[model samples]
Target: MSICILYYKMFMFYSLCLYFLSLYLLNLDFTLYLELNILTLNSISIEMIVYFDWMSLMFMSFVFFISSLIMNYSEEYMMDDKKLKRFIYLMVMFVFSMMLVIMSPNLISILLGWDGLGLVSYILVIYYQNVKSYNAGMLTALSNRVGDAAILMSIAWMFDMGSWSFLNYIDYFLMNKEMIWVASFIILASFTKSAQIPFSSWLPAAMAAPTPVSSLVHSSTLVTAGVYLLFRFSDLFSENFMSFILYISLLTMFMAGLGANFEFDLKKIIALSTLSQLGMMLVIFSLGDKMLAFFHLLIHALFKALLFMCAGFIIHNIMNCQDIRFMGSLISYLPVTCSCFNISNLALCGLPFLSGFYSKDLIAEILSMQFMNFIIYALFFISVGLTVAYSMRLSYYVLLGDFNMMSLNFLKEEKNQMLKSMMILVFLVIFKGSVLIWLMFPTPYFIVMPFYMKIMTLLMIFAGILLGYEFSQIKFYYQNKSLKFYHYSMFFSNMWNMPILSTLGVSPYFLTLGQLYLTKMDYGWMEYYGSKNLFFLVKFSSQLFQSFSHNHLKIFMGIFFFFFFFLILSFF
Candidate 1:
């Protein structure tokens, strides 16, 4: 009857159907491929291909389920906005693009979806129509464009192969060293899309977007696209390339987790947490466990989406104040939302039996199983500690501290739609980890390790909690310690100056180069010899022709008179 009901029923139906389909496919070990031949020219058949394996189906199911919840949440969250229909349209378009990415195995089709994601995300990032939004949108678009360019190059390289279906040529990409460039391009594309290291600044910057968009795009779908693409192409990566990814992802994880501890903005803190988790996914993926990465991706999406939703509700209730410093005793004001937030936060910290623990603990144990250098091993555990520290720090500031906002602030949770969505995710956050592990890994992994090594993860978690509490408790009335060590705090908080490097640090050089080109070539030599000289030469030649033509008749008469004069003079 109503649009909301219709939307809910439609997405719910699709999600259920796809979930069932995925389970069936998984059970049967079957894959379904459908190709629609659009045209054929020069023996090259241009066709659109859809590959329906269990992985794609399961991922799509998650996407649909999340989209449905986010849209429902948006109905309440974005209800006050004038252009609600436009927001809905953009959201649907975003979801459709994600579906295209998940379903298609063809590089050309994947590019179509990838570009769609970039363009739509840019529009969404700038939706607020402000200077900050504009800057953030530009940063997001430009960063992702690097990945898009890589994908385009990969497509060109793949052209040497008859068809653009990368699925059919996974082993070919792996075995052939000549096609290694294509694999490199694909990895590059994933790094940018996933916001690894240098490209990571945009993830937090993109918090300029609406919270709903951030929840949908940053938490679950957009950031994960690169991971999904890499997941599909995991078989193609060489050992060296995987090692390189491993290090970069580990660094990204550490950087994001560390930065979140220092970040003040609530949404940016969450955004940083998303970045940290993404790094974890990539770390696992690069460590030669593709399914483990996907498992984490799915579980992370569920809790992270819930986390963002809880955050949005909190932000809404608190009169749009995002600084956690100004937010305290939120548990007293919005109990349900705060409770949900705590649950999701704990899930993020990989508290036992929660959604994150299923994937994160497994990833840690598996990593320990692998033979890695001491540095890599140490960084991984430290990053894990940082994750807990930030989560605890955020909780202390938001849920436990004294109320700092205005006394008259009417902070109360929305009753109907927003709570409904959060409740659903809370259930998933608590129980879905076990269900997914059981379903996905019918036969569990046999991981063997010493007792001390096994308990290292828990030790890090406890240490992180203590450190986080201590950091929050520290106070000096005269000056903040962070200000005393301003340089280091700024460096760590600013994602190791990646934001500067990506924006101001690199842009000025390019601007300077362009200026040099403009002066030396466009204004100086090219102006003198190319355009300016050519203009003057053309003008002079045109003037000479015009004068000659106009005087031609007069000259003929003058010549006759001169000849008569000359003949008379000769006769005399």
Candidate 2:
């Protein structure tokens, strides 16, 4: 165990060095590509290649950096378990797969990494070997397979272009008549991976995985892949497609925010919060600002990872009880963990001067400047407030107020190994936003909006804090009024039953059709005409012939044939 831990730590340090080197190369505007072979058979040609650019290097470096940290955290988190080595190996594989996705320019190669993510995630998710874990893993894997299949189909469609490395064809997609099919599949693929709208359930369910996996996959890498994919292909989408994507993203953001408020579990609240941010990123990408979305993506990764780590520590202290209703005044017990948690939460809410302010605040300002409909304007602003609102509510329930634990317990933040990993990100969570925004955007955005529109950010922040705090105080479980509107309450709490719709609604309908096919086609019409009736008719005819032959039927048939032959000869 010690040797394995040291091995990953060694890798983590190297990735850090590589990150700085990548930044330097980005500054130099260098792109390096390595080609394996270009095979041509007949009129068709296949190119196998890997391309490296500033964005790929940067994204890869971040992924390696976070994953390396997660590997370190899991060392201590999984120390009590017998299979810590297996856990470490899976994390390494997960990181390797993400890197593959990052560096691979060819769509075909990207599928390997994409499928690797889904497979490894399912394994990581079911690491504990429990019923819930198994179910969650299934949901997660199946949901991601949707994206995987889309990517495969996209690869097939791109055969018309004769190049799987479509990075060079960014502008070609929109211009060419034959290439439009590839773009749509890519969009849908990105949607599923990013947990947009219809594909959002798997993400929260995947929280059944260990917290380390959750931090690494949900906070930083896995969920962001969709956003990253679309970011790379931002130029490919038409305005109409962008508009449709934006509306879907808006619904996703709103649904997640609403779900978070009603959620009682500790980790799931953060998961839902992650979902909301993903939606926000989707909006930015669809609006044709990949750089902005990328900026948010990295910053969100830092703080969200920290958020999950802190939650993990808390859950550890509470002996795996994740219900936030049983949690309160944690700051009084675990000050360091509580502080880190709150900072991440505030960052998530886009608190001014914190890490979130630079990117998230910028997103809000940019959205305000856009010539969008009233609904877009409302959802964006309201979603901003909801961000703060959930943060405040989380604070009220978990960090502030009276102790709510049912039993006497001693909780402390002395898990140095885990805390060490978290502290590394604490610095990033505070500074990464400011640093990344500068690095990514050489030129500044020119925002032209009214003073009222400018202050819309502060309005949302303050309103969210106030509303979140007040709402957190309500005895939601005790109030009779809550019972009076179970359906509407459930609609929001269940994120409009997206989980049910995505899981049950989809499967049951298909299953029913499958049953019908089995009863009517497989068991009925095809069986009768194709095999059963044919066999019965052949057997009956054979039996009739045997009976005639045995009972002097041959002599009778010979006599009839001779009579028919004589009649035909006379006619001729």
Candidate 3:
């Protein structure tokens, strides 16, 4: 109870602070950097650095606000759990870790937060004490370890610069060719942390966590950590490196959007949407509009967290049923939750006047303006259509379809803490976009484009709604299309075989390498020429000494006779 109160206070405090800080920063047009040196070693300063700017403050505000809501929601959602206190403590630690990442500009400090997030999130993922949770936690931790290693490499690579504060040296990257390696390492770290492309399997697997933990991890703390890191280092990235990020992010966007449509699990669908939005943010950031990406990140956090909370409410009421196929006509029972869910879902699809629209629409327009190939244009729009299509499909299966759950199910609106938290977000989901666009962009953006190009967003959205309803239609007379192409659908539904590639496809080589090292290096040569030979040599020497001690009398008589014989021979 005390913790809940504290979080609520912190949320209010951060929101107030963010408003004033944004006003001050916008008016002053300045940034504050503070470094407290702990020690200087070999001309390199080991220090704690904090960067105060509008961006970091804004991010912190969003994180704190969302975390507070999740915490409050957890009070009800996790009421029956045994270790609720431990869960609360872990949640607090998770938020603190994210705070460290947001405020620190130094690579070393950022890594402290980066590693903290990875470790805490792993614990959270496996909170259920099940085999599935354990596997999911392992996947989350191991995947994040790749990013952690990248950060370590970046730190070592930056050793020659005599400073671990990469933010201070962004301009000097061009002066030294080796600094690009540092950028590459940071980008790699961001990729694994953000779960981009090859690293994406962990995000959905992480749904094994409690819904509250999922709300925090998927929405703000874990997945966004990667995007936030790269947002800070955007200036250091070269065109070639950014192109790589662009293509990877584009594919992630399309793949996630496609995957969400096929996914039946409620939380996994939300997780995939988060991935798609992350790709959208990265796509814009790679195109050299980081502030736009940050804008979307802040907005996405609000709705995504709320979406998870709504899903959690439904799952809780339905006795832990997560399959949307078994959950139809939720609107009849959970009108408030259904309303919030649809609003956020449309916001995700960039419905005009919602928070997501202000950033997503701008991203589409800016992307269209970019000089790119036909493939890029097609994927971007198709991904957008997929986003809306999946969202609509989800709404159909979960809200508008026939009731498929057992007759004993009694679902209703959670009217206390859970509803309060979600209602707050519902307000933000509606107005925050317009509010942020006005504050962030004082002068309205002038977009000059043809009529057809202008209507492309609406066109795709309308088409997606139609396609989603068509896909959701259940005609018993017709053979199931998905089962007809079972193998192909499975591939798409399984994140294009990413989970298998990450787990089954990759684990064998690592296991084989470990076995080889154990046999050839650790247990074989080291055993023979190292420990085993030394043991035998010591044993033989000790035995010889023991034999000599046993024959001491005979050895002494032999030595005397040999001396006498030598004297006699000399006399002769």
Q: Pick the candidate with the highest TM-score.
A: 1
**Each model's lDDT:** 0.90, 0.84, 0.89
Per-residue alpha-carbon lDDT of model 1 for 1-572, expressed as tens digits? Answer: 54555666688789999999999999999999999988777756667999999999999998888888888888888988989888888988898899999999898889999999999999999999999999999999999999999999998887778788887887787678878898899999988989998799999999999999999987667999999999888888888999999999999999999989877899999999999999999898888889999999999999999999988988888888898889898898788999999999999999998889999999999999999999999999999999999999999999999888998877766567999989988998999899989989999999999999999999999999997887667523215644656567678899999999899987999899999999999999889999899999999999988987899988789989999999999998
> 1-572, model 3: which lDDT tens digit per residue?
46666776777777678767866887688788998998898889998999988888878878888888887888888888878889999998999999999999888889999999999999999998899999999999999999999999999998888888887787788788888888889888999999999999999999999999999987878889999999888888889998999999999999999888777899999999999999999999989988889889989998999899989999999999898888888898999999999999989999998889999999999988889999988999999999999899999998998898899866766458899999989999999999988888888878888888889989999988987777577424234655665556678889999999999999999999999999998789888999888999999999989988999999889989999999999999
TM-score of each: 0.92, 0.89, 0.91
The deviation in Å at residue 409 for candidate 2 is 1.6
| Predicted structure 2: lDDT | 0.84
User: Per-residue CA lDDT of candidate 2, range 1-572, in tens?
Assistant: 57456755776776677778778888998888887766876655666677778787777777877877777778777779888778888888888888777777788778888898889999999988999999889889988988998899988887766677887777777678666677788888998888888999888899999999999897667888778778767777788889989999999999899888877888899999999999998888777788888888888888999999999989988989998888888898899889899989989998777888899888888887778999999998898888888889989999987787866797866657888888888988888877887788878888888899999889888999898987687646535654755566667878888888877888898899999999999789898998888999999999988887797767798889999999999998
- Among these predictions, the greatest lDDT belongs to 1
How much does candidate 3 score in TM-score?
A: 0.91
lDDT of 3: 0.89
**RMSD versus native structure for model 3:** 4.1
Clash count per candidate: 0, 0, 0
Off by over 4 Å in 1: 1-5, 475-484, 520-572
Better of 2 and 3 by lDDT: 3
RMSD each, Å: 3.3, 5.6, 4.1
Spell out the clash pairs found in candidate 3. Answer: none
